[model samples]
Target: MEYFQHEWLERNLNWFEGVSKLIPSTNNALESFNRVIKDENTLRERLPLSRVVVVLINTWSLQYTANAKTVHAVPTLNLGLWTKAYQWATEKKKKIVSHVNSEGYVYFIPAGQSNEVTDLEETLNASFSTFEEFKTVAFSIWTTTIPNDSNKWIEGTCNCPGFFKKLICKHVVGIAIRLKYANPPAEAKSVPIGAKRRRGRPSKARQALLVQ
Candidate 1:
């Protein structure tokens, strides 16, 4: 038992946490493909060699052909991450509330909305407000950054869709902004998420044709 425990400790989660930041060690594309094979083809039971060949060619071959043209890309660019982080820092930084767990290795930062017209502006033009860290059930899901870092924003992880897709997000970056760990570059204008810069000129308003 002691030997097993020693082996497990040597290969503990901290070893893989760093790996996850680089590349998901256990939850990679190949692992997902293997899971599909086990679940759909074998059903956790050993199949005959002939059946295995049938599953691979008939099922996976078509899937590979279909996705051959598919291009995998990170939606959030590095600049975009910083830009959105700056926006979040401007708008939602006031809402950031943190609580340190007993371990203190990681902390929570949650935000919420306000219906008040003044609060909706979300600018630091207002006076600075003090934030306290403690245990409380004050906020709900989606409003919180799922950052699992002690100090480094570069290593922080967020549960946001943006983060899930890109492994980085405004929430985590906003936390970094609050912590003063890193500053967004000067070119990172505080543009809201989903706002796109239109190419060329806007079309002139057209009058409806009158029945003649």
Candidate 2:
């Protein structure tokens, strides 16, 4: 634990908060000084211990002399990046489900029907023999996205942020849901959202944004 703490300190010396016994003992400041001195010449890089010590003192002197000057730190990024990630993942849910196969290849049918269901197969598959099974699988998969110590889904890595900065990771899951419906082996069906399948009205905020 002490060694790990020391390594952490070395890596983040510039960002140090305060002096505490709990903090690791690592002289990264000295090491950085050494690097600066040796940077100019190959022979100096291999300098003897006496020369190295002199070089270090010079580096520290330079740093202290320049201390009064102000330097800008990196600017804070927008908090909207997180919000955008959530929205993107939610919207892309439908696309990810379109690519699973029985072998977990590029294609697989959802559990239902009698036709051959490919990953891109337009039909929904019903793998479970009964509604109870379908419910169990859907609920189980859904819960995986809830955050936990294991990072089941909510906090773990999903390619959403990497693909598009704010994309929600649900595209793959959405595609999977559709694939479940596409399964031709059983009699599964795509149930529409009870409210309505078509867009009926825009939210007030959306209308306002459009007007702007």
lDDT of 1: 0.54
Q: Which one is best on TM-score?
A: 1
Q: Flag regions of model 2 displaced more than 4 Å.
A: 1-35, 41-45, 68-212
lDDT of 2 by residue, 55-75 (tens): 656765576688943342321
List lDDT for all candidates, in order.
Answer: 0.54, 0.35
**Model 1 per-residue lDDT at 14:** 58
- Which digits, one per residue and each the tens of the lDDT, describe model 1 over residues 4-111? 345644656354233344354346777877887899888988989999999889977887799843544433346656776777666633444345554332433343
The total of clashing pairs for model 1 equals 0
Candidate 2 is scored at a TM of 0.20
